[model samples]
Target: MHERVATTPSLMIKRRLNATPAEVFEAWTDAKLLMQWFGPENVVTQEVSVDAQVGGGFRVVMRENTGERHEVRGTYSEVVANEKLVFSWSWITTPERVSRVSVTFKPDGAAGTILTLLHEQLFDEQAVKGHTHGWTGSLAKLEALFA
Candidate 1:
């Protein structure tokens, strides 16, 4: 494993969700659910495909308010039911700059879940900044879905 230096650009988001771990996990792996909240603000997800298993692939296609289309696809490297997922992340426009994303759902007190998302191995600070904005937006939508 490569140890990340202090300057290695990465993003981490932690939020308390008003749902169980299983529910939160399902929201990530289910196509229909993902379509509802898979993109940043002003980006409407048009299609979603998920095979939530190790070595499986997932793709999400979205359209921005300006009518620009964006697609992201990745392969699952690790999947732990109701607990965690690790996947590669690459946008169609910049497929050469592949990154990694990991999400973990931990049981919080009384039916709630503490979700932590760590996005690493980004190409640079710019990529990290962009992804941070996008992910935070999407996660906010997810939070509202379970709220």
Candidate 2:
């Protein structure tokens, strides 16, 4: 018998947005909008391609000021407009390793949306740490944009 092994890290992030759930979800689904604020200040996406429907493909190439590049690609597992999205994410540089991510948008009250993202199934310690930092930093930028 073979033992099952975990292959990706997990992370959770929550933030409130001034926009509606529909608008927040749209920012996540649209490649152009995602590219505008995807990474840290020192990093920027050079290109993004996304097909937000089930089994659809998505890819993004992010480059740092020093020209280092990281490529991420995945396929959507589930998509529910304005409410939730589920997808399998992979770092192309780390072949055969994949992570699961779920993002939910909830109407917080009258005029704002609460966005929560959960990423799971990580492989190693480094991955967990890296993703935690990345998600926290990225969400901060997103919040700043709305502020």
Candidate 3:
């Protein structure tokens, strides 16, 4: 029998964006917009595709300044315009290590939108720590896009 690997640990991030909910949602679900702010500070997104619908899929390719490359793809399981998105997440090199990502956008009146991103099903605490750094750097770029 094949042993099942337990999926646990999650990375959570909450930030207030200076854009409207619709704008923030579009930044996440639109390929062109995503490419502009999809990777860490030292990485540049080389390619991106977002289907933006339930059952649809998205892919991203990022390249680091040192020539290292990373590719990840996943299928969308849930999509709610300007509100919520849930999708599978997996790197091309480790397709078996699948994970999930959920992002929610909430209106915040004068503050614009409150964006929350939850990445779960990580392989281990190391994965969580790595992703936390990755997401934090990526989000700083995303935040600057509206600032």
The TM-score values for the models, in the order shown, are 0.95, 0.90, 0.94
lDDT tens readout by residue for model 1, 1-147: 999575567899999999999999999999999999889999999999999999999999999999999999999999999999999999999999888999999999989999999999899989888899999999999999998
Candidate 2: the clashing residue pairs are 7-123, 8-121, 8-122, 8-123, 9-122
Instruction: At residue 110, give the lDDT of candidate 2.
Output: 78
Q: In order, what lDDT does every prediction score?
A: 0.95, 0.86, 0.94
Q: Of the pair 1 and 2, which is ahead by TM-score?
A: 1
lDDT of 3 by residue, 1-147 (tens): 999654599889999999999999999998999999998889999999999999999999999999999999999999999999999999999999999999999999965999999999999999999899989998898899999
> Residue 124's C-alpha lDDT in candidate 1?
93
Better of 2 and 3 by lDDT: 3
Error of 1 at 27 (Å): 0.3
- Comparing 1 with 3 on lDDT, the higher-scoring candidate is 1
Q: In model 3, which runs have C-alpha deviations exceeding 4 angstroms? A: 1-7
Please give the RMSD of candidate 1 to the true structure: 1.9
RMSD of each: 1.9, 3.7, 4.6
Q: List the residue pairs that clash in candidate 1.
A: none
**Considering every candidate listed, which one attains the maximal lDDT?**
1
Quantify how close model 3 is to the true structure by its C-alpha RMSD in Å. 4.6
